[model samples]
Target: MEVKKKLLDLVRDKIRFKHYSYSTERTYIHWIKHYILFHHKKHPIEMGKIEIELYLTKLATNDRVAPTTQNQAFSALLFLYKEVLGLDISEWNIQALRAQERKHIPVVLTKEEVREVLQNIPSEYSLLVHLMYGCGLRMSEALNLRVKDIDFGFDKIYVWDSKSLKDRTIPLPQKLKAKLLEQVESVKLLHKQDLKDGYGNVFIPYALEKKYPRSKLEAKWQYLFPMKSISTDPRTKEKRRHHVMAQTLGRNIKVASQKANLNKRVTSHIFRHSYATHLLQAGIDLRSIQELLGHKSVETTMIYTHVVSEMNKAKVISPLDF
Candidate 1:
């Protein structure tokens, strides 16, 4: 029991050392625990490529986990072996039965449908929805937005260390300027109150906290969309004002979709999909769209082309019409 506890502690230490997000740290810990329990709590140092392959194969064959989920599990184990345990995994070529990957078109809301849903969304999340669709931002990107990231003078919004681990800028939506400024002013006031009450520090990303020691207390470092109440930092256990939880926005989106009377399923990501599809429909070139969406490959951006083609099919003259 002591050995198992120490092993997980090492993984957590390494993860924090690398400055991974709290959510990522949690995911890695969960997968690592499951992997150990799957092997009857054998220490990972005693295992190698064959044990890794067997566990992954069981997930696909017996548990039937999705491809992405299986891949996440593989990543956790790989991190444990390489980073935490100081093992070289360069030649571990053991192949496991891979989960079958299925490609499906993402659900997108039409411009009118998007407007209807936005109208139904509670005022609290309205600005967030607008930004998500206007900038084609992922939910995390939107939620994690910092005051410094919004470049009002330059008319750009900087996205730092996104899912691709790359930074990119988006054109600030002209329609949202007033609301955004208002939100900034509101944050400034709230941050003042928090500081006066002796709890105003925000969570700084990566190694910035160590480098710029005073940044945590700066207004510019605060989350753009903060929660109504202060919450304790999961890692530091410090009382800090973090951003609104993803689940809060997620549940409200479901309720807003129902109120809007939309026939299709609605999700936060659907707004992003709609943003890409609408741009394609508006004659925006795929290459430019790829840059705006921060896609690593044009091939990934090409999915929007397929979506547009499917929509265009409805305009074709049928045999009866001819």
Candidate 2:
């Protein structure tokens, strides 16, 4: 038991050392633990490529996990062997039966549908939701926004170090400018109260925190959409105001979809898809949209073209209609 715990502790240390997010740390730990238990608590060092292949194959053939899920498990194990165990499994040439990936066309809402859904969303999340749709932000990017990232003077929003590992700028929505300013004022008030309570610190990356020790205490570094109350940081055990949880936003979106009585499913990413598709419909160039969405490849952004084509298929008359 001690050995297993120590191994996981080392993995945690490495992940933190690499500056991975807490969510990623939790997920990698989960897969690693599951891998060890599946082999009856055998130390990972004792197993080699064969054992790894067997486990992954079982996930596909028996457990029926999705391709991405299986790939994630594989990545965790690979990290364990190569990084933690100091073993080079690259030449092992383990061939496991891979799970099949399904092709999916993303669900998108029409402009009217988007309006109906946004109207049904709770007032508290209205601005955030609008920002997501307006600026084509992922839920994480929207929630992680800090006060300094918004450029009111320039009328742009700066997204830094996003999933694509690229920084991009988005044009601020004209309609939401007043609401956003009001939000910043509210955040300022909340920050003042937090400072008065001697708990104004927000989470900063370890390296940055060390470089600028007082940045965490600054109002501009605070989350744009902070939680209602301060909570203890899972890692540092410090009382800090973190942004709202993704789960809370997701739950509220689900409820709003129900209220709107939309026939199609609605998720946070749907807004992003709608954003891209709507842009394409407005004759925005694909390359420009790709930059706004922060896609690593233009190919990923091209999916919206197909979506627009499918939607426009109504204009074609079928033989039956003739």
Candidate 3:
């Protein structure tokens, strides 16, 4: 696993060129692994640019990966060539063999459908789903939520080091405020229990730990959804808690969706899509939604507008007709 280890380190180093979240770090690493495997485990240092191009071309034509996936592959390769191996990779204008995505709308759940889905979910998982819908949060954001981030008076949740490694705050739903307050009490109990047993210090990013040193014990630094117990931080060798895994939540939602008699392929992101669409449907402004979702560009928010327009399907008429 030497290559795997180096590959992981390479990914971390490469991400520093352009700031990306730990989530993106994980995703980039996965694609790099797949790319290496596709070439029958040939090392990137051994392969020339032409081989890299051909491999990517093969992925587009033969493997037929989706456009987003293909783009991610391109980015990973670009990073490998430009940063890791010191090679020039320029002008990727390649296209996937399949047609571009056009006029496609994201699958959205109705209010009743969302309610039923929540009802069908086992009680343990319901609160998480509520947070996802009630606040326009990506599942990872919800998973990484810490107890201190909840602001009961302001009805807001702080999201730090999100997908872009940038921090933003999204409002807490007024309806869910009561439940969140209760959850806060629950996290306090867990923290106290950890103290009594001598499970000292909290897990934070390796660099942050060295910088703040004492933040680990701070009440605000505790994970809103803390891990079951402290584990040795692989990077620092100190015991700390980390966020819950997204895959765990994904599996739980998948099984619950099936049991709820829903047929859609319900990944954790489907809830995020539903979040945007439902908010737009409820007469929330696009700019407001964009801010809440932490979108850097308004263009990203425009997609939800398309979803609503597609749903309405009203006919156009001349002024005379009016």
Which prediction has the highest TM-score against the true structure?
Answer: 2
Which residue pairs come into collision in candidate 3?
A: 146-224, 147-224, 203-240, 203-241
Instruction: Give residue 302's lDDT in candidate 3 (0 to 100).
Output: 86
Q: Model 1, which residues run further than 4 Å from truth?
A: none
| Cα lDDT tens digits for candidate 1, 1-322 | 8999998999999999988878889999999999999999998889898889999999999999999999999999889988998886756886999999999888888899999999998998899888999999999999999999999999999999898877999999999998999999999999999999999999886578779999999999999999999998878899999998999999999999999999999999999899999999998999999989889999999998888888889789999988
Clashes of each: 0, 0, 4
Question: Where does candidate 1 have its weakest 10-residue lDDT segment?
Answer: 85-94
Q: Residue 159, candidate 2: how far off, in angstroms?
A: 0.6
TM-score of 3: 0.82
Whole-model lDDT values for every prediction: 0.92, 0.94, 0.76
Q: Assess every candidate by TM-score.
A: 0.97, 0.98, 0.82
Q: What's the ranking of the predictions by lDDT, best on top?
A: 2, 1, 3
Better of 1 and 2 by TM-score: 2
Q: What tens digits encode model 3's per-residue C-alpha lDDT throughout 1-322?
A: 6886786687687785455565677777787788788778888778766666676777777877776777788787777777777777675444434424456577777777787787876666678888887777888789878787888878778998776556888877888888878777877788877777876467666677779998887767777776666777544476656656677777888888787788777777777888899889989998998888888888988898887887777555658998
lDDT of 2 at 239: 90
